[model samples]
Target: MTIKSLSLKRKKTAPHGLSEPTDLSAYRRIVVLTEGHTNPQKAKTAIGLLRFRGGDVVALLDSQTTHQSAAVALAHDVDVPIVTSLADVSQPDALFVGISPAGGRLPPAMQGAIYQAAQQGLDVVSGLHDFLVDDPALVDIASRTGARLIDVRRNGFRETAKHASFREGCLRVLTVGHDCSVGKMFAALEVERELLRRGADAKFLATGQTGIMIAGNGVPIDCVVSDFINGAVENWTLANQQHDYLLIEGQGSVTHPAYSAVTVGLLHGCAPDGLIFCYEAGRTTTKGLDHVPLKPLTDLRNLYEALAQARNECEVIGVAINGRRLGPDEAAQEQQRVSAELGLPACDVYRDGPGVLANAVVALREQVVD
Candidate 1:
């Protein structure tokens, strides 16, 4: 019951002569491996955009039955390719990987395969959420390999602006996750009000719950995601309704379909200047810790390097913190570590709670205008 098995059946076969890849020298392809449909749409949009700009993309999507099965699926996704490894991927132009915490330190089999790939001289880009890596050994591997390991949750704050510009003088912000993060919601609203008070036309877009709330917060929980997604095209189509600056908020883990659908829709519609990823640093589900602790790639200088591989079309801004209080010191330290690892200014919402961040957002908006 805990372990779910999944096998992919290519809906359609590739064209004959085209079945065997030609010289990839001119075309750099990217293969995206994921656990199920949760964020495949989002991952696909990102992968596609990056490829369209130049690189080639090959996505190997998967569906893990239980959350615990994510690692298993990732292991398979990676190893399967090695078993049927590409002829020219040996010297790939670049490689990107999205790792979930449950997938826990790439399985030994996959690690061996990766080592082999490295022997062939392939540099890989990998990502992790803040809470996923508490293990020292795994972090070490990322460091030595020179892999771009990132904490996806917060890659939005500092890095997103590269993709979508903020209103000349407005705040560029977003709320992540599809499930309601009352903490993040209130924080965004207060920031908006503060920006308006300062005279900036701060534009805000809500994905999933936040979007539903924008249409009207009383939305039924059951239809939350569908209503938001269905209404998105119409909402975006409305002119004069657009703001000089844009901020999008994601609610829920990257593994949720709502999260995937909304993010993909946003990218397909009007890709944000940047992506802001908010995660519960210590938030735990029945499946254990939800975030991947990526201790590796700490010295790479910012998560942009890793995100560039995950989704290059947009700049990534990351915000990380432990949503729960284990201890004041521990929470603060975690925030510091996350910020340090990503090479961005850390927003320790836990210290002053949401109020301080709300105020800080106001200050950031003002600076943006200046």
Candidate 2:
């Protein structure tokens, strides 16, 4: 059913917490090292940062795809050069390990390149589970060269007693998804842009490494201790208290075997006024774990709404479909099917614009007032 048809009522209280936005200006001129993996699906961090970050991305280091532009490889029409080695890059402030391989391990062949960057006194940034700072060789090199090794996944945790404080007049909308890499961040960003274009006081809150790189301020929620996951979210929300709308980026899926905790934590953390459920069309199961089948749209909606209502009243305002893999006809058909099944506005935010979901948020806000 549509959000208006849902029985949930809005809570009149604000969540409690403390948060400080991150500073990304230090990463002004960066060299993204993708090496063997340079495709969009694999080099998500590199592509995202290059696409959204306001800083100057000097080059994308990929030996195999040297001489080709980012537009050719990722099909995004970015002007950054793809170089074979760091020697080809000009003066850069940082060297970012931009690919998240299957096991999150640093590629063996790329270690020498990282060392080279460290030797040159350029800051090194990595988002893998394996922390580069922990490596003795890299640590020693960075210490000697006066370069900093920033593990985005591990660094930046401000221990605070403050939790998320729900703001009275702000409209907080979170983007939830069926699985990781389902375009939750992309949808949330587009929605925020659309809201701003409509003259709404909207703000986008980043929750992951790529988003943090883009927004210049956000907590990598998955890196935080489990005890403080929700607390981190609440604190981030509280930081944007002045905004009329806060479009918070969501993490993993509730059904994901490995990352469900992050999903549930974010859900309760933001205590959003509304949610936009994101799903990738033509995907029936979780990535990597083929055994876990994706829950149907109706079941997924019920699960999200039930959990949200248990804490504070919330509803699934609309559906954002990621139709990157599907043809136009197929995407439209899938969108129509999902809308009919869930009885909610459904569209691909990237292709169709975020108007549908943005309209839903505006309508909901007006409904609350009336």
Report the CA-based lDDT of candidate 2 relative to the real structure: 0.79
- Alpha-carbon shift of residue 142 in model 1 (angstroms): 61
- Model 2 lDDT per residue over 21-70, tens place: 32554566788898888887788888887766634688888887744787
lDDT of 1 by residue, 219-243 (tens): 1112224434423432332321345
- Which portions of model 2 miss their true places by more than 4 Å? 1-22, 155-164
What's the true lDDT of residue 106 in model 2?
Answer: 85
Among the numbered candidates, top lDDT falls to 2
lDDT of 1 at 92: 47
Give the per-residue Cα lDDT of candidate 2 at 229.
82
**What is the RMSD, in Å, between candidate 2 and the native fold over all Cα?**
9.7
